[model samples]
Each structure stands twice: as structure tokens, then as C-alpha cells.
Target: MSNIRGFRIQHDSLTEKQRIFIDDFSKRYTEKTKKSKNYISSNRYHLCDWMNSLGFKLSLKEMLYPIISHSSEGAYFTDIDGNRYIDIAMGYGVCFHGHKPKFVYDAIKERLERGFELGPQTVESGEAAYLIHHLTGVDRVTFCGTGSEAVMFALRIARGFTRKKKIVIFANSFHGTFDGVLGKMAEDITIPVSPGTTEGMVEDLVVLEYGSDAALDYIRKNADGLAAVMAEPVQTRNPSLRPVEFLKEIRKLADEKGFLLIFDETVTGFRVHYGGIQKLFDIKADIVIYGKALGGGMPIAAVCGRDDVMKIVDGGYYSFGDETYPDPYVIFFAGTYYKHPLSIVATLASLKEIKRNGNHLQEYTNNLTSILVEKLNNLFKQKSVPIVVHSFSSFFRFITVDPYPFVSDPIELEILFLLMILKGVYTWERRICYLSTQHTIQDVEDIVKIVDESIDEMRSGGFSFTF
Candidate 1:
């Protein structure tokens, strides 16, 4: 009877029928994914996939192994066990163009064949930078190995440019695992969220609510010492909540207060709109960190911004063998694989395709997702289920209403995902999923069908959904 707001359900809390279902489900899942489970157990000490970090009771442990992906194509992937699924997870948004997009894959393959030359600038870097500038209207672009790395660099640039130490972040927004930004909201200032993150790392962080008048007031009161206000524009976990007005206000404040506005668009970048939240809302940010879909399913991230703010990269722009020289007050920015050829080529290919298709690519996918969300919500309403599906562009999540009489157990919430997996849908952690450009009306119909069947099965198995 405890309505615990926790990430998981305890095995002992299930009803007798629920327990029987779990037992049978776990056995079948383990048998189906035996190789993956064995691989996890064998590499338990060596390999660490945080997606499988949640350790359940031994009896239910079999449900934890990720599907060992053998191959993937547009809108679908085949597991090592030959289970092909409509991959709504879409590599957690990295495959916005869908798995193994030919344009990106071919570019990467060509780059690999050409062999990456070390200590030299990549040939495609300029083209990639141009595409980014053309799309986002940013003046400068810098690359890194991952989103976390790009976040760190963005913070460093903000501090260097403004000569200020503090930053403002929002609660319920994830800005990668970078130590400086991994802070939880506190009474006044932010505190480190993870154990290894020292208190001093987040000493200058001010964490507050994402979209609130109180948070805006706090920022206004303390704008002088703040270097930047970093936000996810639209949070990855809770796609339903869109604070366009709040973000526009923040943008205005950033312009007036003389502090940078950093949009951490690691997950939202091209998935929502080709130009990300900036174009979607017609609000420009001082600096934007991009990853996920920007990489074209490759490992890459970028920090881009206004020329003046981004000038901190080399202190100030200088010409070759001219009066202007590299400024001494520059922040050190370097990475061995900063502009790796393969990544650059992939980015170039993806951006070009996006440009060729214009905004239609995103518009089509976003429209499809909206239709899918409406269908699922209609089903929930018709069945009187205390559940609703919310979406922002291609991203969507299921939310269960609290203290609802139709839902007597929290185990039912977890079972929805298990049933989804068994029914050939690729669900990821936190019930977050993304649609790809390859997902068609047919795919949406299939997803709706699977969801309806899962709900009906749960109802028949004594899971309450009636007032």
C-alpha cells in the first residue's frame, strides 16, 4: 500500500498473481537472453554498463540484461537472439536518423578506409562547422569526444569569458556526468550528486527549479556573480514539461545581465528540431552544447556560441603572420580526438542530409510521434487506466497518476515495461523513448497495437484499471 516514489518495485510487494507472472516472465526472459545474461555475469568485474547497474533480487535478476544488439537498420534492430524490434529507444536519441543511416554510415566507412591522420586537422571539420553555423546561427564551433566533455568545456569557456565563478543549473535537468554540473538542488547553493564528486567541485553551482517565478527571481537577485545559466531547454526525462516562456525569459535575462545562457542540448539537439530549441522557440542562447543526434550515430559533441563568448577558446581571433596574435588570456582547450576524421565525416554527412531535406525530416517525425501519443492516450482513457503518455517532438514517456483508485499496485507500472519488451518493443531506462526519421505510420500502428495488447493482458491478469 506504500506509494513509494522510487525507480523500481520490490519483488515481495507484488500480489500472488503478479508474483507468478514475474516468475514466469523472468524465466522466459532469461532463457531468451541467456547469452547476454551470461556475458554480463562473466564480465561483472571487468565491464560496467550503467544501464544494467540496477541489481534486483536474484530471482528477478534475469530481467536485467540488455539485448546484445547484433545489427540495426532504419526503425529496427535485431538482437543476438534474433529478436527484431521496432527500436523506439533509437540508441537513446543518437540514431535520430535511425540505425545505420546510409549517409552517415557510408561517410564513416570512407573515412575509415582513408585512415585518420594524427596531429592534423580533419578535412571535413570546416564543412561540419559551416553546417552547424548555418543551422544554429552560432558564430564558432568546438568539438570534443563526448557530451560530458563538451559540457566541461562550455563551463570553462563561460567562466573564462565572464571572469565569474558561479553557474545556475536547474533541478530535474541532467547536464551529462561532468563533475562541475552534476549537482543536486540544495537550500541555497547546489551540492555534488555523486560520491566521487567533491563538495568543492560544485561550490559555485546554484541549482533551482526549471520553470518557476521564484527561480527567476533568485537569478535576478544573484546575476552579478553568475557566469552562466545552463539548462536542458527541454529535459530528457520529462518531455511533457516544456517551459518555452521560461527559457525565453532566461534568454532575455542573459542578454541584460551579461551572463551566458548555455543550452545543454545533448539529447534534444536535432531530435526535436534541426536547429534544436533555439529555432523551435525562436530564442537564441549565448552558448549551446550539442551531442546525441548531432553525432550521426558516431561519438562526437560540440560547444558553439557567439563569437565574443567563444573567443575565450583562443582568447581572441588572430590572423596568420599578421599584427593580431594568439591572446595570452586564453583557456586551454585540447583533446587528442577533438576532431576525429570519422566523427567529422559522419557529422558532415548527417548535417548535409538534414539540410537537403530541410525541416521536413523533423516535422514528419514529430507529427508521427504526436499522432502516436494521442492514440495511446485515447486507449488509456477508453480503458479508464490511470496512465497517460506525454511527448515533446519525438521523445515520449508514460506517467501514472498518483493515488488513483484504478491502480492499486506500483508493480503494475514496472510490468508495463516488461510486457513491452516481451512484445517486441525496445524500451529503455526510465521509460524514455525516441522516434526516428525512419519511423512511419505503420510503425506507429504497430507500437499502438503492442501497447493495447499489453494493457489488456495486464487487465486480464488481475491488474486493476477500473474505478
Candidate 2:
């Protein structure tokens, strides 16, 4: 696997003239951290050393510092820096209460006092399920540790319930990091960018463009053995809002065609509304996947749906259920730490607060976001920049009409991302964002200001933007 050292350099915001400055800053940061921590010899890199040791990709390089440090936080930001920078990406919208939120942590503490786990049953898990059921009006939930696992169950349950294997998904929508749902981004309105995904999977998976009238027509014509039609009604493309009519038609088609409707609200669930984007869209699904900020920043996810649809894995039939322990019939869902009490406790507290406050981040932050989009768009227009501001709750994307990983573009997106990092803000390689409660109107204004400054600075470094 190609490591990130080169990736960082290419993605960094330094022109040849500015590279020396950034390199000097990096060296200073390293030296400062080492002296402060007073590390033994053979360990000069500090956080960088650990990251290099682990070999896992961290945020766009600049984020490496704060993540290790755990800076300003509460129900809002837990910045990596000693100072705060309004966390708009609440773990890409998962940490609803904010970084290491007191309520969540307090709940975890209470649960830890009670004992984190037992033979199997825990009060928090059942309570979490009950609360989830109440919130979504779903009949049952299968607990899992991440968005991908929940989605996998959803697919299997759909197949098992309908006795079908084909899944219909829309263009460029993401479910989880599983092999199944991760392929093909839209190109223009016609061509698509599909990486090494096998044609067979694509064949088994039905692909539809967002508003194509051909969707129902396609399903009507070829929904044979189709198990489910899954989507994030809030399209993950930039703004994350559902085309209102698009959602209604999808629901109509799924019903008429007798296939399951699945909503992968992994990103939008609680952030958009306590009821989720599905509720706002006036649509329903047989299953829904929740993650990102859904676990309030811990690793937990849910696959929930109507009861009749979720009975596929009843008792010990699947390998998971095949345990010979003389226990009552239990669906096999044992990760070494799925439903760890601490996470469940954190979830319970976070849900209570979210239900009470009701996704205030989206509401309070919208005006600021609108201002930002307007400002950024105007600046782009003024500069004739090719970038678009596909804004959503707190996060946004700057996708290229010319994109890659789906296409060949050695003029890597990483470089642009690094430029932003070199400017000092992290947006998770352009995938996720989390917001905190601490951001004031002033902070929002300042963010836009910083963006403008960053743009000008980047231009000085020879970057061009032509609307």
C-alpha cells in the first residue's frame, strides 16, 4: 500500500517557494512537541511517529496534531488544538452532543460503575433499542458496531425477507465502507466513475440517477429478484438534501414493485432532524442505517426496520446463531465489543439531549451556512473559480467536475486539500464533518473570513480558481 508521506506532500498547500516555510513550521512543531513531552531518544517525531507507526491515514495532515492532543471540548468542540475551531464535522455528524460530551461521558461512567458488560444482556442496550424504536417508530433493531455492519444486515434481511438478491441503489450514494455499496460516482449527467468494482456486483446492484424518471420505469421493468432499494434520502452529494419529489417517487416505486426500501441515513440521521431526513422527506424504508454522529462519536450503529422484515436471522440458524450454549434463542450478533455498555450509555444520554434540543446545530447553523455559501460562491464567481459550494448542515464538499480515484487525475485532489490543511483547518479528506454546540454566530462569521483569507493565500501560492 502506498503510504501517506507522498500523499501529504502532494496534498499540502505549499508551492515550491512556500514549501520551505511549511517544512520549517513542521520541524518547529515536531521539535516543540518533543521538548515539551520530554521523550526518550529514538523518538523525535512525537504524534507523527505514532501515526507513522500505526500506518493509518489521519486527517489531511494538519489534523494529526490536535487529534493526539484532545483540545477544547464539551458538548461542542473537542479541538485538537489548544484553542477551539468550531467543529463543524461532529465526527462527520455523529457527535451530536460534541466532543467527549459530559452527559455522554457521565452516562458511560455510570454504566462502568454498574459493569461494562455481562454474560450478554445489558440494560443500556435494551434501553437504547427501546429509545431508538420510539424515535424512529421502528419495530426492532439489530445492534452492530459500525455503519457497514448494520448495512450488511439490512441487505441480508431484505434479501431474506423478500427472498430476493438484487439491490437497487442510486448513483453516487454511499451506505457504508463495505464492498457492496462503495462504487461508481456520477460523471456529468451521463458517465460514471466506477473503480475496480466487479461488473457482477454492479449487475446485481441496480443503479439509478437521482431524479431520473427512468427509476420507477427501470424497477417496474426489471426489479426481478430485487431485495431492496436503498438510499440516503439526503443525498450525500454536497448539500445532503433529498430532492423532495425524488424521495416520494422512490417510496412509490418500492411499494409498487414489492421490494424493500432501505434508507442509509448513516450521515443524516439525527443531525438533520431528530426524526431524520426520511421523516422530513415524508418517506419510509424497511431498514435504516445510522452512524457517524449517531453513536455520538463512539463506534456503534443500528439496522432498524419494521418487524416483519427483521426476522430473517431469528434464533441460531446462521453461523452467528449456531452457538450451542443452552441459551434462549438469540440472533447471533456478537462482536467482541458490539453494544459495549459505555457506547450504549453514551448513546442513551446523547439521544435524550438531542431529542430535547432537537438538532439545534442544523437550525442555528443554517443562517451562517447560507451566508458562507453566498460569500464563497460570490468569491468563486469573482475569481471565476470552478468550485461549487454544495453546502449542508455543517459540512460541504468541493468536488471537481474533474474528479479522480474514479478517473485519472494526477493533479491530485490531495494537493488542494493539503493547501487547506497548510492553511489550518481539517475537513476529513472531504468525506465527513461534525458540528459542536459551542460555535457562536461570530465563529461562523470568522470561519467564512478565514476561508476568504485562505483562498487569497492559496492563490498567492499559485493555485487558480475560475468559478
Q: Relative to the true structure, how large is the alpha-carbon lDDT of every model?
A: 0.83, 0.62
Q: Pick the candidate with the highest TM-score.
A: 1
Error of 2 at 163 (Å): 0.8
Candidate 1 residue 417 C-alpha distance from true site, Å: 1.1
- The digit string of per-residue lDDT tens for model 2 on 1-467 reads 43322343445333675555445545644443443233323354443453332322222243233233355465333333342345555566666556777777778777778787645767778787887787777778777789888887788778777877888788767676666665553432222234454555554566677667777677777766788888777666646444778767767777877888888888777767677776666777778887766676688998888776766555322344565443343344556777877777787787787777755655765555666667767766676555566767655665544322313332324444434444445555343444455556665566566666765655564555432
Task: Give the runs in model 2 whose Cα sits over 4 Å from its true position.
Answer: 1-67, 75-84, 183-203, 315-333, 358-362, 382-384, 400-424
> Candidate 2: global Cα-lDDT?
0.62
Clash number for candidate 2: 25
Winning model by lDDT: 1
lDDT of 1 at 382: 91
Q: Residue 68 in candidate 2 has what lDDT?
A: 32
lDDT of 1 by residue, 200-296 (tens): 9999998888899998998899898889999988887677778999988988888899999999999888777888889988989999999989888
Q: lDDT for model 1, on a 0 to 1 scale?
A: 0.83
